[model samples]
Target: MNVHIEVRRVNEAGEERTRTASIRDVARAADVSYQTVSRVLNDHPSIRPATKQRVLDAMEELRYRPNQAARALVTSRSSTLGVILGSRGEYGPTSSLAAFEDSAREHGYWVNSAYLRDTQPETIRAAVEHLRRQSVEGIVVHAPQVRVFDILAELDVDIPYLGLNTAERGIVELAEDQMRGGKMATEHLIELGHVEIVHVAGPQDWIEAESRMRGYLHALSDADLPTRAPILGDWTADFGYRAALELSHRLDFTAVFAANDAMAVGLMHGFRDVGIDVPRRVSIVGFDDIPLAAHSWPPLTTVHQQFAGLGRRAVTELLRLINADDAPPLLASVEPSLVVRASTARAFGHQ
Candidate 1:
């Protein structure tokens, strides 16, 4: 017996239309049992190569797509992951989220994010519960605040979660080596004969800020240089501008290490306004070699963080945990490199 059915449905225009191809249609077109089609869809090993090829050809001809949601329902795998994201508008987090979703989709999974408007304990709990109810297999925590980590640790949520750009204490974390970047930035200035270096640091509570400040201090300690009070900032260009104004009154330093590029550029602008000639009077270096860093009035010297690579690895690690697979051999962390530019120069009056 031979039977091939063309599925038909009525459209909003009151006209008959051919619906999208389904697995049953593939089975009918391939002249195979529906169960055989299911086996092919799941890559069952028992299916002969000839039969597999035939099924595949039929599927390609019919433009058939298996319903991921339906497959998920049957296999108890939602094929979806969740992310708890903070600092959504920042360059690094924004770039990382896009790259993370791209990598997840390439692996046949979907990503959902719950942006934290407030990092309060109760608010964090509610966000966690919302994602939990969505049946996401795993979660990536992109909240960079130390307090957020404490909040997440207190929650009893059972889902496997990975923290991005976080510390390595009792948590699986992925990030470019920020301390290395910080040290590299400071060392660049030190090598240029700038002994009196100041650091424009981010908020103390941020993991990156803490690590960068530590690295800056370490570099000074190794050089037998005394540490000065760091100008704490909010990671904003405006803050950098203000810090530069403050530093103008105390011309004790020959160089400034701004924690990130945004602040560094603002510091340059602020110094110009205050008649402090950069490089000649004060050399500047920054972390996170953002795109605009290269195009600034004087191209910036900074450390480049691999934001995309970190995001990709975060998804990979989270998936392994979700699948209950043994952890892969630890790979080398992504190393940031120093990018020298006109923003840095040899110390003024140095030969």
Candidate 2:
């Protein structure tokens, strides 16, 4: 008997041409029944083990390949989730996405990623719409900008969603305690007998930056030290460099707490250019104990945020949201810890 294979072809007008093939053609080749072949192809679990093997063998003999799109049409599940991120080059966002992808794969889901340079409301709306079009079951918004939350609040999508690293109001959120991180860094400096401490802060618009700034003030107030206005930065090495240059000219403070390790590294270089000795003339502390922090001159004393763990937890929460598994939406806040290193020392007089 001739075994014919069905194929789809596009006509000159771009319409599909469908053709049919017979199950008898497949079953005869492997000496199995058409019923057994149907059961094996449809993944019916009731078939006996020996019979199932014969049906599979028949399919192999006929070189049968199942149509995934047809299967999806019946199930109504695309088995995909969407992740929207801000700034792919940043350490935290990039690491979170990688972790989420791995976790999604483990749960038998595919992740569609979209990275944005800025988190404007319109841009976020567009991104969310794009993901919805792809039939994603849920969404993980990784943009930390406060405006993204506003955009999310206005969205009409029926799918469940979660935000990582953004502030919490009513929605489910997963973030590090930035205020605690700031307080930890500042209090450490104060404990070292550095009363005149300055903060080099990240952009004011970002919730993380604002929280850290508040923590710094809280620490200073508790210690009875005067809190100076913080110098603003864009969380970049360049911004840190420029801020350091401006601060070095006057040299009013004995200690500095930069919002992140990259800025701290930049400040160190800036101070070196001005012929100032670190931990002697001025001690410095930084947040986010990134890899480069350890290699910096005199090594950086910094705050460690468990970025990878944050990523893992965020994805886990997102998966729960996707499954409609009767789990409560989680609001997780990770605490920051201080990592003491060589960049800080006793006050100039005590040493």
Residue-level lDDT of model 1, residues 206-265, one tens digit each, is 888988998899999999988988888999999999889988998988899999999999
RMSD of 1: 3.3
Total backbone collisions for each predicted model: 0, 0
- Model 2, which residues run further than 4 Å from truth? 1-72, 169-173, 326-334
Q: How accurate locally, in lDDT, is each candidate? A: 0.85, 0.78
**TM-score of every model?**
0.86, 0.81
Using alpha carbons, what is the TM-score of model 1?
Answer: 0.86
Best candidate, TM-score: 1
lDDT of 2 by residue, 1-351 (tens): 243344467889999997443566567665677776667767789888987776666566556665544545656667788988766787767766787788778877788877766777678778888887777878887765788777778776577787776655322333437788899999998888998999999887776787788889999999999989899888888777778788888987899999988899889888888888898988999988888898999799999987766766766776676665776645455567899999998877767
Cα displacement (angstroms), candidate 2, residue 299, comes to 1.4
Task: Indicate the worst ten consecutive residues by lDDT in candidate 2.
Answer: 167-176
Q: In angstroms, give how far residue 15 of model 2 lies from its true place.
A: 18
